[model samples]
Target: MASNKPAPEAPSRFGSEYVDDFATRPATAFGTEYGADYATDYGTDRGSDFGNDFRADETGPERAWEEWNPTEESVRPVRGKHRVAKQRNGLARSSTVLGVGVIAAVGAGGMATAQSKPPVSISLPDSIADNLPDAKSLPGVGALFSGGSEAEAQEAVVASAPLTTAGITTAEAEQGSTDAGEALRARILQQAEQQQDAADAEVKAAAETAAAEKAAAEAKKQQDAAEAKIAAEKKKAAEEAAKKAEALRLAKLAASYAIPTSSYTITSTFGEAGSMWSSGYHTGLDFAAPTGTPIKAIHSGTVKSAGYSGSYGYRTVLELEDGTELWFCHQSSMDVSIGQRVTTGDTIGRVGATGNVTGPHLHLEVHTADGTGIDPMAWLRARGLTV
Candidate 1:
């Protein structure tokens, strides 16, 4: 926005700083107060009128020209100001550039075109064209001349004639520049809409692809969790079924076994420390009972031996099918003979106080096929029998 302030007067061609400056100074300074100084400088006498001195000396005005000579500092403007124009717009006035161009063209070329003639375009470099003055912004210029460049002014150069109207429709041609401008604007807007739609479609496709990948990842995570849970459940079920089958097998084995003695109480267990026997530790289980109490066979086995042993008094040995041996010691009598086959609960001996026995009691021992004695109680419990 240019300021609406008043412009200072421009320096004139005839050594005038302002057009009204002469009226502000003294009416006659040269012939009166400074007359002696000027006369001495020019070697002439001062007079009210310069008509005699001007004819006599050809150097009258030339001698006085030194006082009015403008220097760079004296003529420098305080601000941009002009009388005819409130603001500076270009290199020069619009009419001045146009008139100069036309005069130069006429002098160089003899040809001239009428209103019916096609337009003639003059091309200039960008440096020159950008600096051309605007005519529409001038003081008194009418709408006849546009403020645009020469290219824009081509159609208006001769409005009565048609120039470059090849692509225009009949309605736009008759209607004026307004309708032609609207048609060009419509095409530009349509192209912009198509570009916008293409960008929106690309964004939508990217969003859908990302959504599908997220959904697939979530589903895979759930499936893996479900498969792991099913595997854990199957492992637990198999372990429980194995436990149930083992219990059933042990129940059937318990039905085939029985305790060796009746009306007896446990008086000594295996692995007991005592000095009474020769081995220092008791190697057999003892059942305390009244004399003549019957001792039965624990399991189905053959009689390995039946005799009166030295410290054991009368004794009996039974051998099971799996090469395990059962010995009955401290017995008062033996009933099973050698080579006799007996089932569980068959009488094999009688409890007594013979053979270094404490009171009346039956001593029992169990061994593997190698004759190594083990705890009778534990061995009998393994076969599912109490006592």
Candidate 2:
């Protein structure tokens, strides 16, 4: 008879404590895209189940196997999505590897070109061309994606031969002794220096202008002062010339005239108020002297008369060309007759007590053409003769 009881599960070949494939293991595709580092982490997948899809490393020594329960995770089929056993997956992995290799090759070439290295061109033998027929026609992997100069980059696509994908940039390289940034910096410094030079020139021009203005101002001041001094000297010279001319005129007039009597005293003047004269005023200039004092012609004139009257004893009359008359009365004796032309300083008579007078004197009278009497002393003084 069999007992209706459950049988005990057999122990695993490795151990009893087992690891959950999905719980404890790091997730990894059997074939990852980077095929090179794929196996590097596989051995250390943190308690991975060897019985699962991961292939054990054949080159290293065998590692101890861990226990694995026959649960759904372990007994289920391993994910064959990226397995090399699957033809489609295998093709995809191969294509991915080729693309990564191409990208790496292009990156290395780009770095070398950036370092100013010479580009490397490729040559494929005819036998290798048939093996990689799609290499020249594929979109990203085609020769059009490869890099070179402008002419060469364009030519590479049309070229039947394959070329290396040396990563030259599409934009043209700048040609100069220095890069753009350094050149721009140099230009900025040059502009700054030019501005500084212009500023200096402006300052210099301003200084020169100021100096010129100052010099011009100084010259104007000097010129003004010189003009003033010259004007003052001219005025002084004119005044001095006028004074000299006046003195010469007076001297000439004095040379042409004479006094009426010499060594005589001026006892009476014209317009004197006295009781002795019948007209109540002295009408002539009186020159009192000794009885023998000689009387001279007052100026160059013709004597109109020389006579002895009742009160004016031995009187003489001198007439000028301009009708001015000089009467010499109270003369002791008359030397010139009427109409006698006489010169200045010629003796005409002598002093005497005449004209109902009290003493010896020569009485002289001056009258204009209308018989209007004037002061004899004033008339004589006007001709530069002092009596």
Candidate 3:
């Protein structure tokens, strides 16, 4: 182990002098250290140089300490330079912008949601109940929507909301939609009936028109036939009247052709003298005169005879083409010979009482060519001469 030894002391001073021992230099100590040590060391002296230095520091004498403001090192100027963007700064700004965009998107989405909402009400009419038919009365209708879900029932009720609120029964609401359906069925039936009636009326009218036309045509035809018959009858009557007039004219012509040969006082008619004469009382008219009275022809004719006869002394006969013979008997002189042509009022002979004559007279006889005797007065009356 090492010996524990203390270190040697350093040199010492006493007051204001270097001294080996301080008490031995009391005068130097008083004038130096011991004299003003407290006052000069800390400037606490009242009248020493140290005291003067303290007073000067308080009184600003000769600037013992200068006035001191804070320099750049103490309070550096507040930095005004714009800060650069870094990852940390960018993150803060991005967070603020994202917050505003989220707010705007939220507002736009809320408006779209409001616009897409459905209506809660519907409109319907009162008279809709009268149109529907009863579903209960229809065949197989009860099983149509039976055993359905509540959602199905809600849908069905909502669909039938128009009818139910209009006071329609559930049975009636199941039948149809509108009143127009019922009206259409009724209109169809009524139109069919009307068509049948119209067709029947048209047929009847056509038959009536045809009948009227036929009747009119028949009446016209009958009238035409009647007119034709009347015309034929009138023509026949006119022709008959003309024939009668011609006959009358011919009869008048015949009556004017007769003449009497002798002018006599007493005459014998043609048929009445037969009973009074010996062969005949007088065959002709008797003119009581002397003999030789002139005899003339009554009409133009050819002389057929001028000879004697048994009862009459001479006789003359004339004939005409119409087969009439004129005889003159008891002539005294015959001027007309046989085959001689004589004219009316020509002197043919002289009247004489030659044979069987009570007085001078002439017997005249008119005979047909077939020797048939007729009434001479009647025959002459037919020639249009009054005899």
Candidate 4:
């Protein structure tokens, strides 16, 4: 027969002191004796005990140990949750690397395509096509775009090709630039030529004007010369006509007067100097003739006196209309009476040897209205008589 009392409890593996403390302290998942200081060790030692400490009835280290000891299935999810998060981060890093690789591959492919392909086709309008150079004929155009060595031959074929999305070819752009430069140069040359032409025109006009002026001056000179010649001819004609008129007047005057005597020789002229006269010079003209030669009147006039003087024998005085007195001395006889009218060429007296004469001669004297005598030979010549 056994007594009914329980046996004494065994000491804990931790120690009796720990068990005694655990019995006296408040209940916790980790034993009160272990407290916060032993919790990490207990959790680490019972890492597989998951269901032990979580029970309501379990307390202290016993419950902590039981709860801490867990199966692999129960704890596997917690570690797997963190591992899933890490695996997601790694996947994101792998995606970023793959995207970068794809971008690099696409960029390389685009660069290769751009280097191999030709540029875009450019169509010229019909109006400008005739003026532009053939696209293929441009340098490097056929080889660079049309895939041909002969640029000229490939021009037509390339022109018919379909249009592409690329831009204008390099050759076409260069041709356009060259054409524009040529056009600008042509315009400049044209303007220069026009300016030169205008200058030439101005010079020609000036030359023409100068030539015209010179011609006009020459014409004027010729005209002046002609006018001078004409004027000189007219003056000469007028002088000749005046000379003819004077000759006619002198002829008529000669017809109006007559000589005093005819067939007589002149012995002495008026103003002759000799020792024969009472004065120092002979004052009358002498005409020697036969003693009975007839004496004519010099002009139409009245007989002023007829008488015999001391040295003059049978002298007669005739008075003309102008009051000039003509005296005929040493006459044989007086034909006209005193105060009788006489005509030209009338026989007024005859020549004779007078008292003072050396031989038979007629002494003719001319006296003015005041009785002043002048040379009778000059007086006869003034009346158009040669005597």
Candidate 5:
């Protein structure tokens, strides 16, 4: 069937198989189709032109070889860059080390500064500096900062000054301690001496008081003994004076009385025994004398009788004031009359032997008022007259 579309062309080895009657063809197509030498000519011509262009655009091989050889100027930039990079790395390392060292130094310096400046100020003597170690010889202080700035040098100088000054202060403190010890010992010695003195004074005072008391007691005892001696002497003298006064009173009474008769010899006592009398014993004392001797009155008395009685011739009786009778018996004569008064030493009668007499004597008798006879010798002696 004939359709109104164009017919499909066959696949050719050169290109699209469709051909136009008016289309232009390439020159290489003619040579390819005819298998001619035109391809060789064209290749040879282009090759020649390429050779000519290469000759015109580039230098010779000798010149290129010469350009490729390295020179000092050519290597300078690379080495410079490498050297700069190495220097940068070195600077970085140095900076890092410096930073760490600065931090450590600051920490240590802060502690040192704090210790050096105390709360209180202490000034030390200059002589201590002579004995100190030199700051330049110290390890991390002076030598480490020798090439550093002026501020670092000043810091080292400041750090070394204190150690020398502290040595002088220690010597002064030792001297002060020695002086204080001596003063304390002296004060203790003074107090002990004062206490000892006070004790000695107290002992002395007590001894004095005891001695005074002993002296007073001795004096009192001696005074009492003397007073007792005086009282005994006075009593003895008073007793001797009383005995002398009694003896003088008896002497006066004897002088007032008298004896009845004198110059007569006693022949018989009142109590004598005889057979010559009318009674059993002798009743009267006998005074033997010559006849007519005077008889005296013994004391002042009145005559009661003067007459001859039996056996008593010419008798006389005298009565005294106390009622005692004195009888002159056997008298030769009566001198005193009846009712007559006679005194002591007066004549009352004469001695006789007329009353149955043995011899010429007076027979005197003492009787009471009732006519009873008593001893005549005892009656006379009582009046202080010795008979």
Candidate 6:
């Protein structure tokens, strides 16, 4: 009585179209002709009737219902998974709002923390310590920090900290008069001047000390030089006095027998006609007189040399006490022989021009024991004679 084919399913208004969980009308999962399409199933499983499991594969001709165009009704909003896009947009907006609130909270917390804190203060260990004598009292630190009196120290501190007029106004407050500010300025200037005066005094003192030291050194040097000069002069005077005393004693001993020439004059002195004498000089006096002029000894002495020396013709030398020698040269003849003792008045030679001389004369000279010639005029003067 019934046909052997299955009955057609209920017709949908969108032919072969169905509503997904999102409420969007999609074409049948299976293609037309009631087989499976290639799409995967995403619903509850049932029997082969495919009521719960969607047909996921089909190899049939394209369906006319699959080509249906979108309509206002199909795009209408619905509930459940249909609102998924709106939920996602709402979640993004909420997350952004939450992030902004968290940032704002953190910023507020940071401001509050900063406002609650106190400003940092500066201090040094020396500022609080009372046991220490002062900054200058530390070991090896006295030279580093200049020392000063109490007043000078206060002045220095004020000078180092200058205050501007505007700063003063602020510090005094609006109720205070400008006179107070002027007074402060004057005080600061006074302090600075005091400090400068102290430093200037110190510098002056140091300079004075240096000058004093230099003066002391110069004074010491001068004293030393003066002492040395005095010592030298004293020694020289003592030596000269001793020499004079010795000379006087010797003169007294020789004076008893010494004699001056009775009739002869000093016609020539020693060292006369130096160019003609073999010894480079006529090293004796020449007394010009008659053929037999009397030649006398200046003191009691032994004849040391009596001979006819070259250019001297005839010569005689007398050796006195204290190692003195007297030379008689340019003589016509010698009256004394060698080693013969003669008084001051004894005739040792006669006046003549026997040596390389221009006229008849007698030459005389005096010498030390060592044979060094001495000024005969000086020797004669020492004996109280003007010759």
Q: Which pairs of residues collide in model 1?
A: none
Candidate with more favorable, higher TM-score: 2 or 6:
2
Q: 1-387 in candidate 3: lDDT tens per residue?
A: 232233332222222232213213344443354333322322233223223443311322122232247887987866664333223434643343334333332332221111122334654465775566666433344334476566665566555544323544355446652444454565578799899999999999999999999999999999999988998898999899987886788565544333545454445557674643676644454444446767777777899888998777788988986868987887888987899988767888887877766677777777898987766656655554454
Please provide TM-scores, in order, for all candidate models, with all chains considered together: 0.47, 0.41, 0.35, 0.43, 0.37, 0.35
| Global lDDT scores for all candidate models | 0.68, 0.68, 0.59, 0.69, 0.63, 0.60
Off by over 4 Å in 1: 1-251
Per-residue error for 327 in candidate 3, Å, reads: 0.6
Poorly placed runs, candidate 5 (over 4 Å) = 1-250
The stretch of ten residues in a row with the least summed lDDT in candidate 1 is 56-65
Candidate 4 TM-score, true structure as reference: 0.43
lDDT of 4 by residue, 27-58 (tens): 35443433342333332332222233332113
Highest TM-score model number: 1
Q: Candidate 2: give the clashing pairs.
A: none
What lDDT is obtained when candidate 5 is compared to the true structure? 0.63
TM-score of 3: 0.35
Which candidate, 2 or 3, has the higher lDDT? 2
Model 4 accuracy (lDDT, Cα): 0.69
